[model samples]
Target: MIVLDYPYVSRFLTDSVLELGQAVLDTPQARRLAGDAPLHYIDEIEFSARLALGGKVYTNSENGLGHVLRCRCNEDLARQIDICKDKALFRESVAALHPDYRFRRVPFEDLAGLDAPDVDYPFIIKPTRGFFSLGVHVVNTPADWPAAVRAIEAERAALNAEYPEAVVSGGEFIIEQSIDGEEYAIDVYFDAEGNPVITNILHHTFLSADDVSDRLYYTSARIIETWLLPFTDYLRDVARECGFRDFVSHIEVRVTETGDIIPIEANPLRLAGWCVADITALAWGFNPYECYFKELRPDWDAILTENQGMATAMVIGDLPSSLDRTRIRDVDYEGFQSLFANILELRKIDYHQYPVFAFAFVSLPETELPALKQTVSQDFTRFVVTE
Candidate 1:
């Protein structure tokens, strides 16, 4: 059975699917498929959207393939998955569990409610269905709230102009009390039988100027057995309580000064980008891409045997000056990749166009983290960005 996986975005899936098929046609592998019959088109997004919008349904058809395996599903599940971007429903579900998780909804017309009392300054303001950090802002005080609100308003106006029909369906913005602490992302996968499996845990290191706080990068590993493993039960309970079953999820949490692990947000899908896959492989000897392809090899099990003796970190370089006007070609990226001698695995380059950030995963002896970071800062210039 041919499974045509399209980009996750519903609007771009058609073009992305056609482009993927065309790329396949240009490859040498396509010649080998010349004798095969017509390719069976199985569009995941279309199928999902049909179930979501058209009130259609689907069964899992197989076990161990996905958490949704062999299940009866409806439009509600699909709509919830699609419309509640960034697992907003999960956050709302968990919020109901606590009395102190109070949040004030700020409307586009009147954003003054965001300045309510007991509501701490420097809190996070984000669209209810936002992705990435698109329209998110951290307002430090009452003085900062107006500017943040105006910024979001300007962004919404721009989006409305570009896609007039696609109005912002969720009119409210969420003003959440920020959890001050070190930020970490945990990637969890559930088996077909409904077991909470910890795939990887990544400590996101923010790389930005003192003036800019939103830009961030991450590195991950399977060896997060120190403080993470002990909290797996808590995370699992949170996931199950939120109605998340067989799927990949990225959970971000903060370990506060009081030693409480507060849930920040959750994304109910594969963690975007390659840095995650690179770090997971470097530390555990198996890449999650393999799991995505349903390979299910014995090496997947080897990750469980991996110990938490080493510390792995990902260093992201500043955007190259020449990237704005030029396209990078024939990049001899080996110089950057070769710097880490202890790197067990290397994944593909993952970066967005504008920021031009690049990630590399390096494994260091747990005791040598400080010196390693210093060495990286000293030696990072060798990876040149060329036009």
Candidate 2:
């Protein structure tokens, strides 16, 4: 039995093992939709999650206490790091493992002024409990500090109106010295015994240093080819150090040129947003969601032995524009495909909470990245949206 949170389920991914006769989906929405035979009903979200995920299950939480408590059928340990959800708290965990880690917290209202006078430049300031990169600022210099603060404040104001319940509204954000090197996003599931089973390791291609928007943010599974061993080892050590077991984490880290591992943060929740989480399926033959439910550990040696070609996932939206929610009303499907190729799967939908023209791209290396990125730019440019 798998517990599915109604709110987290996506519309594009449906018809999965859970939706089929493979596994039972337990959720409030599923129960409600079942009507007279509530036990037999399934949630619409499970399908969208499947369509995007290519049939993976959404299970596990980093620190989802409410979710763990809601249904007795769910995993209770998912909330092992409830306090760790806050960036400051998680930083403590990371710092404990690595003494070189550095971070501090400042009130959201003081972000512009940054009450800490000695705080150096070229740092990152983000909500203690933030998601989707909202209110995230990278201050490169003293001059950039004011603008960063203003940008964060403006974003906080907008979020106050739109996402009032966000943890950012709680008043504090964390600051940390920016680590130098390649940034990678790792999606993994820990078995009951605390062994981490990695689903995917993505190499992040950002638009710019200060671009907080997820738009133009691209991650390719191709990275798994070179640095998988080192990253997997790092995450395993992090999980053990943080005392995480029976959970899933989507952690971001910086791999220095010399191979030093620095964790940015681990949002110990499921991986990715929308169907982006499912990109693991394209990277590997199995679905990441299924890994959690089935408690499957990736047999890297065997899987890699059989797999051919590489998969890349790219996110294109109104990035490099504004953090303000961009409402998309129209999408040029044909036009979008015309620009890019090797498109394994693409799902364009209105992410109500984020409110932007967001789509997940699972592409094969049949086409070069430069050509693919050019098409992605055109798709985002022409995609109709209320910016």
Candidate 3:
């Protein structure tokens, strides 16, 4: 029941868990138990060894020390680490055990084999272990492949030079056959028994036109679904195959021209960034943060049984100019806050720290798509960040 919190997303998770009435251990105490806390109240080795030997489950042990501890407690933690570390291996193992389940791995170099004559242009390339869209590229044509490869190589080289210890050795990037369909994301939570109990779906829209190339983009709107019959079966099969019994998964899927469902990629972790939490609250009327904390909460039957008229949009603010910086300080925060009061649910004001990244969520009674576009364009100018 101990929870370690960090950043807004972690705070949201911790708060949600607490709201569910779960007794969570504080970070300091948890660290102390794990033998990393600065306090001298406990013997580090004895405490951690006892905790592991006593069958206390530790979460988020992906760090260096965590890896070492897991290795030491191999008898208890080996299955979890092996299942979590290598997804392709897990898929293969599952497919072997369950012949009915279909699993395929198209290597980074084998994408051209899947290409059909009608398989349109603009495919995406990505690394198997990539996150947050890093090492992702879109190839518009066969001619673009070499240049894209060169760019990726250059970036990798730079990263290696700067932080050689941080770079993974001998990593390969996968070139996926792009599915030219609308993008949607599903956030699924599995129980200890490996059942996909709670699921949420969101429609993701890319901010930059270039970002839509082949992979790596954010969603503009989300629709959470509690009872998803069609998708739940496939998701459960995947979860069981992967040996992921208790964790959140982010699944990317696309609807093809023929209305077939094609799964693009899956992340065996929480949704990156803030949109998942935001959309869950706005669209589902439940905070995922809160739900995640509730121990053995009843599985949702069918909350978002169908897609509602509600829509979500993200505004990617442009970089401010020197002139705008001079005037940004003069703007009235209270006035601008009131001006855009009706349309805004979340406003991230510090764009400079992150650089050219700000997002807003809007919910309207009617789907005034054109009016929504205009509102964002006009309102963005009001909060110019001046230096």
Clashes of each: 2, 13, 12
Q: Flag regions of model 3 displaced more than 4 Å.
A: 1-11, 20-121, 157-170, 207-210, 213-227, 293-308, 312-344, 347-356, 369-387
- Residues 48-105 of candidate 2 have per-residue lDDT tens digits of 3442333333343222234333332323343443544677877776676678666787
Q: Write the residue-wise lDDT of candidate 1 on 140-244 in tens digits.
A: 777776788777777775333211111122366777877767777776654544355665676665432212222233343343645555557767666556665
Evaluation by lDDT, superior candidate among 2 and 3: 2
Ranking the candidates on lDDT from highest down gives 2, 1, 3
Clashing residue pairs found in predicted model 1:
60-70, 67-246
Off by over 4 Å in 1: 1-73, 79-88, 112-118, 154-172, 192-194, 207-223, 272-275, 287-308, 318-354, 371-387
lDDT of 2: 0.59
As for lDDT, the candidate ahead, 1 or 3, is: 1
- RMSD (Cα, Å) for all candidates, in order, is 8.2, 5.9, 7.3
Cα lDDT tens digits, model 3, 186-304, are 76667677787553566655535455422122222233342256567767777666666656556666766775566666554454343334556655556654444342442444443
